[model samples]
Target: MKYPVLFSPIKIGTMEVRNRYVVPPMATGLARADGSPTEGHVAYWAARAKGGYGLLIVEAAAIDPLGKGSPWDEPGIWDDKFIPAWKKVTEEVHKYGAKIAIQLHHAGRQTTHDKIGGQPVAPSPIPCPVEREMPRELTTEEVYDLIEKFGDAARRARDAGFDAVEVHGAHGYLIAQFMSPYSNKRVDEFGGDFMGRMKFPVEIVKNIRRKVGNGYPIIFRLSGDERVPGGRDINDSRLVARVMEEAGVDAIHVSAGVYASTQYIIAPAAVPPGFNVYASEQIKKVVNIPVIAVGRINDPLLAEDILESGKADSVALGRESLADPELPNKVAAGLTEEISPCIGCMQACAGYLFDSTKSNISCLVNPFTGREGELKVEKAEKSKNVMVVGGGPGGLEAAWVAAKRGHKVTLYEKENVLGGQYRIGAIPPTKQDILKAIRYYITMGKKYGVEYKMGVEVTDDLIMKENPDVVILATGGVPLVPNIKGIDNPKFAKAVDILEGKKEAGTNVLIVGGGMVGVETADFLGEHYHNVTIVEMLPEIAKDEQAAVKFFLMERLNKYGVKAITNATVREFLDDGVVYEKGGKEEKLTGFDTIVLAMGAKAYNPLEEKIKGKVSEVYVIGDAIEPRKTLEAIEEAARVAVKI
Candidate 1:
């Protein structure tokens, strides 16, 4: 095999998986209100197993109703009534010759009163900084009851046909609360020193072993480093792993971060992929059990290197699994380029999971992630001649999906290169992932027989000549040219022009906006030794950007010494800089050698009106209808393509 260690079979206790590929526990938020696994959830897990994963660890299942920590639709094993529904999921996964495990968890202080119906419970009364709610400390007697609940949950998982049970002692959950001194402030046996903090998870593993018997596998997952102030670090996790091993855990799954340190929890595109393998290596030094490393293990070669180096027994793909469920199968078939890569945008999965209005999670790259049951692309009843205008992410996705579904698709791009604005977006540092996605779409488009007509303008006459049955207008957006006096400088450049290498700004560059594109353009320029200053009308910069992504972006901005002027707007463009309004006062800065407009974008549906009534079935998708991120554009494209 090309990836020998990654594709090798490994045994965790009595369970011998088909290969080392693992899909670690990730909440789908597709369960019923009663906490039963919905058909979508069942199909989601089964699809991963069928994709050639050796084992799939289901997301956090509450041990009690009040333990619900995530979405309103979190899975549960608190009652035996939930077993039959869970059994269906495990049985379906097993049909693909894959072993399945369930992670027993309690949200503890991470939850709110609205979620658990009351004050949350934890090892101490300390309030979680992120949640900002004080938890009611568990009584000594109640702590013992919770321990038994963990054991009972494990036994129930076994009965539900799961091959193993994972104790969720990570990510500031209930078990982690008892393990971390940052949260465990009690003076009882469950608190105090390292050994005391270790007692809760240790006892839970022992109880699980007693209840489930010795043969059933018991995996204990914990954060090697909490990545917070005064919280447990690698030294503490090294001890936690050894103690869990002594308590009879069959394997050790190492993850990182708490709620406050969620950048590590769901590291954005700015964070390096497979950056936490060292944590698994640290934990592996102290424990004899198998250590499964998980932290953006997106690439097959990266997973293989971790295994070959003996740092981890297996690697877990989390959100990357959502982006492409068939990653393992594609890798095994040597079709790695065909696998759609996760761009780490986090707009859909983390964004939707946290939004109360959203009941389920989906992927920016693959919208079929959560809607696996109903969102599928089979051959169409009758092939249609599809004309896709533009070659941005939305246009590429629509062309690929439509052509894959038995349609004759011809994608038209006015530019010679594809990816449109997305290609320019990938020019900033640490943004190669975005380029991978653009390439993936193009490759998939080619594979599915999408005819490429680059540098060809799609006029109404040309459309009528081709006589396409359907017209998908993904003609994207254009830079919003603000209406300011003296703004039409002959040398002035749009942010996209700077990123596209069409314009070169002077050493002292003044940026006119502070949105995602504006800020990233500053970073791109700052790297080239340019003095950058961003001016925004809003109080904050990149407010709409993902939190984790913004965290890293702001750090880089500070490192590059880029100055930001917020709550300000340029009233008049000057010869060098501009006259800006800030706090009801006008100020002028004239030292800048060049001024660039980063003032966001507006919908550029130039052909939508001209061809709408002319085409029989005309649909304006993506930025042609609205100016937003590639997330919504591709999501709308996927929705339209499957129907067509």
Candidate 2:
């Protein structure tokens, strides 16, 4: 279990990281709309630090008043009011014996007027691709002002009790826009040649060094490749990394892509693990400063190999950290099975943060993400026996939390095994990572002394016989079968039936629903067996999903050649075909041997009235509250468990 060079301590300027496991700067958009930190922000970072990360760098906080990017929640250091709030975060990390840093940023052309209360001003008058807003080019005097602003932000970060400061010069932001020829099309001294464009970022770093002095660590996040055809590439990154090192940067964090090249930044699943390690290796070879590599560094062994091979000094983990903040700690303690794995499904964290600003940070599998403090399971006043109904993610999490709080907990599941719906998701070729989460909960429940009763249905009489103080109904939802002509026919099958081996799909299959579940089922079938056609009543598949997750799902479905038919209703199921209407035209498609129903699920709330006043405390969570993603179910169950 010896970690390769990943566990080696390395010094960056005056700061020494206990290990090479660095939690890279990733924006969760958990701040208040007015650039203040929220409790969610505190819980998010504290979890990672406590989980044993060597250094946790906060997300990009703008240095200038007008440089804030999105209209949603993102923190800033532009004002003095932010100091005490940031100090709260720093103190929480210090308590865990982990060093923390803040990434200082300027969005430049990437800034949106809605967030900053003014139009964005960049180095040139070029219009942004996504924003479509023309920016007023900055004057030389304004450029100098920007440099000083960055310096002041660095000084404030140190004063705020941060161990280090990171200048966000990557991801096609302000300094990156200046460094990239694709955005900085200016002819002045700050433009024209590569050195001219590089001048601004170097000057910003130099000024930051002058302000923070020689003792403080200052790392530069560099976009190794813009990934846009003619934009910033490795050559440009190398040149800039050397300049940053010469300008007194203590480290270079190599990353890839921008908003323009979406796939590169996010690094789709098709991309290999440690995909961006090449960029960091290139930067590390040329610069004296330490280089950190990110992008799909999910496997601990793989990360260790990258460090041992000298690809970079540190492995920067983002989604992995979000998936399990205690991943490093678990690995260090040789409890690898205890780690909750992040499956690279960005639905809960980045997906919700970008799509819905109001929702707090979440994990697809981990329910206690943002509500860490409020959701802690404290020992019960008196040891009361608890009975949890069902064995899904919600029920399992509730049972585990209650047991941790020293409650005598017992769980009952009608099914022969645990992981209700999650077991189906686990079997799909693309969803192996989800199984890790299910296993983690099961293992934790056993560790916490919870009694598990599988294949046992809990009725009112059964619950009365148990005589528990608290009854948690996590009875999972059932699929809502639409009253279509062929839905109940022998030729048709429910998606769950196919998933659970109750029914088998033929070579040619017609999936009746196009929502997230249906679409995923289609993708699964199409990946292993061809001839899968998805028909939906809605115009778009996965209509309830977040934009980013839907986008990736759509891409995968297309890649698998899963034909999607929307705005269509199923008419009848035939022995050799399916009848559907598209645009008021009746179309009978032949040659499909099977039809799978995947419309959606209905919440099973059978115990509402029965458990309403029967016990001192009654809680309904997961699918019983609402049929939603595993993320919502787990989060709801955890929140309620802590309160109970």
Candidate 3:
């Protein structure tokens, strides 16, 4: 009722979505090694459906197993054997009155030889700038085979009871490779002119229509702008929309970016929200069919506004859905504040997909993302007195869930604010979204009856006086103070203090440590017209940061005239500047200003050693266990909370 247009039913060909909330297909890497749908994958989609999403466009399925997109295992529709397993997902989604669609995809040259078990195949023998591996050019007959494969996948999807099928002609995949001049340079019919390049997808669409008949919805996911030189631009995107319409496709779901423009694909917090809506609007001008605008449409009000202004017919929530599956239901119920916001950290959703250690899709804020069935907060059989130390994300999550499960939970924080270092970390540019997660924790804590004791240091005496059944020490971390010459000087301040606005730097600032904190500190200072230089002992700065997020951050820092000297060791801190050694020579960089230290953090567990053995049930989490990102912190705390 609040967002009438956003909540309104809309038709995509023969299928009617219950609402305009579309969960766009995001790669979860949830399928088996053989490319079959797993129970976890089915549960992941079912949770979103039950949460009140109108339609779910499942993550890209390989039409050919050899065309697998990412190195991670993904679903496949190349074989008939996958149909029955996929049907479980559709049946579960349909039970909640939500229609589901499958995305037919191929990696093309976007992947590496190790991923697809060969030199990767594309319309042309072009190597993706990011992947750097030259792909084998597809033969004329092979191209025709792939077209039929797309048709076969669509027919299988319909047999599996899916309401629709999406041709993933976006994100620099196989279809996108054929459509773009950047990669397509063949002398064959599939390349050369715009229409020739368009012929591949056009024929694929026509083939799908012939196989699925005229009734089933066929949505073509188009990348409005590839964001790379000589790639598919908005002009080409509009023409593709018009041609796809003529080819009998039902809708256009416009996303942006290629493999090179990875920033736009996931759109980190640095990128403005709903920035790609302009592309969708441009394509919508040339097409009568529906156009769904995606890329960073996080807020529900923004989705409503986009629809109200006629910029897009439907709004897609990709990573936002992972952060909170119940977002649509919460918005429909007018409890917008309760909706868990995606901070766009890329710490989990995009982070996991790219990280070699992590293969499944998850969220930094919401641990229940890919593990939907695993991380449920069930009511306890017996209630107990739970005392949680520290008010950070991990501690807040632990206390909130414990209270929700009928435990009498009391949380204590040394600082008055609850978010701890994460809250302070939000001070940098494009990082203010981090506070949303912290605020959500605080809000949910109140809703779940969590008692808070602010600025109260829980000591051993206090713990003994009010003995709790369980004690969770999430005391967080202290800034790392490495043993360097003249390191104990009273003149320099920590990066945390600078972020907290407790300390102001001079015009010229020298920062020690070139990790995320150090780089962001430089950006924070550079924004205020300060000349900043970072010295790191490592080969690069912020090497641990998410690649795409780091790319944009580095770009902003460069604009601010921030200088970084890598493989340099800071030997001594003086009143004027720091003495550093680079290339085996000691050099003194003279500067008339503040000597700030952004030397990362170390685990602060002073109380853990003292109280661990004393408390019958004691657990330490978050930075107290080891200084890390919010991803590990929240997960560690949740794992402990469920057990308690």
Candidate 4:
């Protein structure tokens, strides 16, 4: 009753999904180098199925060796040997009463030559704007052959016992390449007019229909709006949807953006929730088959609203489900508070996917996401009294986990409220979701019987008084103000002070440092101040930021007209402006009414040294150990707490 529409069953072709929730395909990179599912992949999907998702669409599997999106470690269905591995995944998902689907994919020009053992193939010789890897145009004969390859992948999926299959036609892949005027400039029959561009995907659907038959469900994932100029928009997607439905497709999974606009694909906190619903609504009007809306549809209540408004038939959860596998179950049981919300940080999920060194997907808040089988919280052998210092994310997570493991926990915070510096981090209008993690931690802490002592600073005396078996110091960090002339002037303020509204900026602002904090502060100040300039010693701004996030942040900076000066070192702070050296040349940038110090933070671990020998066991985490990201803080806390 809490979310009737979201919990209700829906039929796609002959298949009946128990709810309107669909886990759209997300690349996990948890497969073997040869593109077979590893035990990690099997356990990952099985966990989601057991958590009560209705329909689970597995990550994209390359249809052929040349179609791989990544160089390695992506599942593939090109060979019969891979069928048994996929069958195990399907069987595991079915055991929990969930229908599973496999996405048959071809990366097209999105891939590199090193990935596919040769030049990547596409509708034309044009390359991706982002990747910039030129692809050879698929020959007319090869185009038809690729369509048959798609059919072959679907037949293998059926033999593997999958309930459905989805064609990966979106996000500037091969099919989308043919559809977009920006990517496909071929004058051949495969590309020219709208219908000509539509020729390849249409033939693909028909071929897949022939292989899977009319009974088996077939979903086509489409980018409702490519979000790039001259690319396919919702209107074009509406036509494609109608064509696919007429071609016997069972459903349409609507997503947005291309590689050039990758931020919209796996949007961060800057993008609002339900970002793709409007496009889905437009596409739904032209098609009879079910339409699934995706992109930052994180909350169950939001999902319900989208369904009740008649925007789409189903709501697909990608990263939200990764944050909490049991999200649907919690919603159905009216235990929504227990569900861990995805903060849209993108640090662990999309950040890792984009990192070639760490391609495995995980969640920032939930450490057990990708390592489902290995990292489990088991009860401690003996319950111990635990004293936790600070009330930030790390301390709260440690306390919650320790309490769940049958430990007596008491968390102390110097401030009246919890969340530590995270409170200030959430002050930005776009970053309000950061506070949701703190709220979830507090809620779960209370449920697990963790005691809280607010306005109580945990000094050495306090720890000795408590005399707990274990002491965890998450004392957090302090703003680092460089020792420079005139730095103590009233015009200079810390970034946190400005964010928290403790200090006000003038018409012109100069922010020192160009890391994530500095760039974000520049974004915040740029909105109010007419002139905002950020100076950093590094060659680039937001060097530590994830690629997709950095891309969007830079776009916002450009939009706001904020001037960024990198490779500049501050020599001194003057009353009106700052003196800096760039490329070994001294320069004076005047006319700044206010200066903000966003130079980052230093660890506040005095208590760790104070209570080191006083406690039987001592641990330092979060900013208390060293100022880092929320992902590192929460993960370190959980890893240490579970062992205790």
What's the number of clashes in each of the models?
0, 0, 0, 0
| TM-score for predicted model 3 compared with the true structure | 0.99
Local distance difference test scores for all models: 0.90, 0.83, 0.91, 0.88
What is the descending TM-score order? 3, 1, 4, 2
Give the residue spans of candidate 4 off by over 4 A.
Answer: none
Better of 3 and 4 by lDDT: 3
Superposition TM-score, candidate 2 onto the true structure: 0.94
After superposing candidate 1 on the true structure, give the runs of residues whose Cα lies further than 4 Å from its correct spot: none
lDDT of 1 by residue, 112-185 (tens): 89887899998988888999988998999999999999999998999999999989998999999999888998
**Could you tell me the TM-score of candidate 1?**
0.98
Every model's TM-score: 0.98, 0.94, 0.99, 0.96
- Residue 512 deviation, candidate 4, in Å? 1.1
lDDT of 3: 0.91
Query: Mind giving the per-residue lDDT tens digits that candidate 3 earns over 1-644?
Result: 49999889999999999999999998897888899999887789999999999999999999997888775787899999999999999999999999999999999998877777877999888789989988999999999999999999999999999999999999999999999999999878998898899999999999999999999999999899999999989998999999999999999999999989988988999999999999999998999999999989988889999999999999999999999999999999988888788998898888899888986999999997898768788999999999999999999999988888889999999887789988988998899998889889988899999999999988988988888899999999999999988889888989989888798888889888899899888888888899998889999998988988898899988899888889898888788878889999999877658888888888988777777777789999989988888789999988888888
Q: Write the per-residue lDDT of candidate 2 for residues 161-261, one digit (tens) a residue.
A: 99999899888889988998888888888999998998998898889889889899999998998888678889888989998888888999999986676
